[model samples]
Target: MASNVSDPAGARRPVIGLTTYLERATQGVWDVRASFLPQQYFDAVTASGGVAVLLPPQPAAQAAASVVLDGLDGLILTGGLDVQPELYGAARHPLTDPARADRDEWELALLAGARERGIPVFGICRGLQLINVAYGGTLHQHLPEALGTERYKIGGGVFAENTVDVDASTKLAGLIGAGPYGVHSYHHQGVDRLGEGLVVTARTDDGLVQAFEAPGDDYLVAVQWHPEENSADRRLFLGLVAAADAYAVSHRGVSA
Candidate 1:
């Protein structure tokens, strides 16, 4: 295999695919469905020595996912709308975001293909929920209702701050340490049932599953908080980039 990314000055910059949101947006004189991601995501990747590739919702197909992953070293399931309840055999929560069937199908396919290819993956917020659901786990749908508190989410597009305790035995603790770690959060749903083959790496005081990792050598970590929101801490991003770099080296692709 050859490097599939451009190598300038003989430096290796792993190509990381960050999933994006496909939503209706408005510009000057236009308002239509568009694909977009926050700049912080790509910035975190590039800052951590990896190239960021925005992967928007596309026609859900295993073949499409395979083709997309063929050129990438890692995959990121980003934060966004809630995962449809039907995905995990649940009913709709009145507060859950409207169904994003296309995104749901597309991301699930990408995750499956990425795992099969032994590619590193990182999930944030909604990403974590999706990963859990992918592994036969379930979500709480509404944290306020389940937890009986609005600590995880505040109104007016504000991010709440929370603390998570990492398990010393898990891989996550190795990266960020095993203790009370402060994090930025803006989500209402969280893991309900532990996913098969997934280890719980962290949790909040309320016993909400805050983080988990898959059982494998390949990098697979997911957290309920929004790490991207806190630009000061890029350890999570760096971990993914480091894994992706190794992946690119072991599984070389065509380099331009």
Candidate 2:
């Protein structure tokens, strides 16, 4: 596989595709649109010398994944609605918010294809939960009921700060450094059982899962917070872009 080297003639920046959300308008119609991510997300990726592409919700998984995988150097699944429990062979919980079925299928397919092709992946908030479910893991659906903590809120208000203990040996620790840093939290669901090949690297003071990384091989990571909401937290995006750049240099574009 030839490396998809950014042609030096033109400032070739690695392209990263960010998953989007679907919204129902007042007109009583569901529209597929690219949700606004904090400006910090773009700044973070741009700071790392990567091009950020906002990916809109696609209707089909195979077609969507093909197009996304072809042009992207990496995939970043942004936070959004809850995932359908039916995806993992479980009944839908009464408290579980309606899932975005289309987004779920598309992202799961995208993540699976990325894994098979060695494409780098970064999962944030709902993205983390999606990765876990896509990889045979389950989510708590509603965090407060499962974890017994109202400390984390996801109601579109100002983000609340929380402490996350980092594992000294993990890549995440290397990125954010040791000790508990203030993280912005805004999610109602969390990983209940981890996906295969993923090891927890960070946890909340209350023992809730905060972050995880791919063990042994692969540049895959998922976090339960919105690092993009903080422009100051460039390390998270840098780490992801760096991994994608390395992977792009290694695998390039050999279609599977």
**Each model's total of backbone clashes:** 8, 0
- Tens-place lDDT per residue, model 1, 126-205, is 99999999999999988888999999889688999999999997779888999899998998889999889999999999
| lDDT of candidates 1 onward, in order | 0.88, 0.80
Worst-scoring 10-residue span by lDDT in model 1: 1-10
RMSD, one per candidate, in order = 1.9, 3.7
User: TM-score for all predictions?
Assistant: 0.95, 0.87
lDDT of 2 by residue, 71-103 (tens): 778889888778899987888878888867888
Q: Cα deviation in Å at residue 252, candidate 2?
A: 2.2
Misplaced by over 4 Å in model 1 are 1-7, 253-256
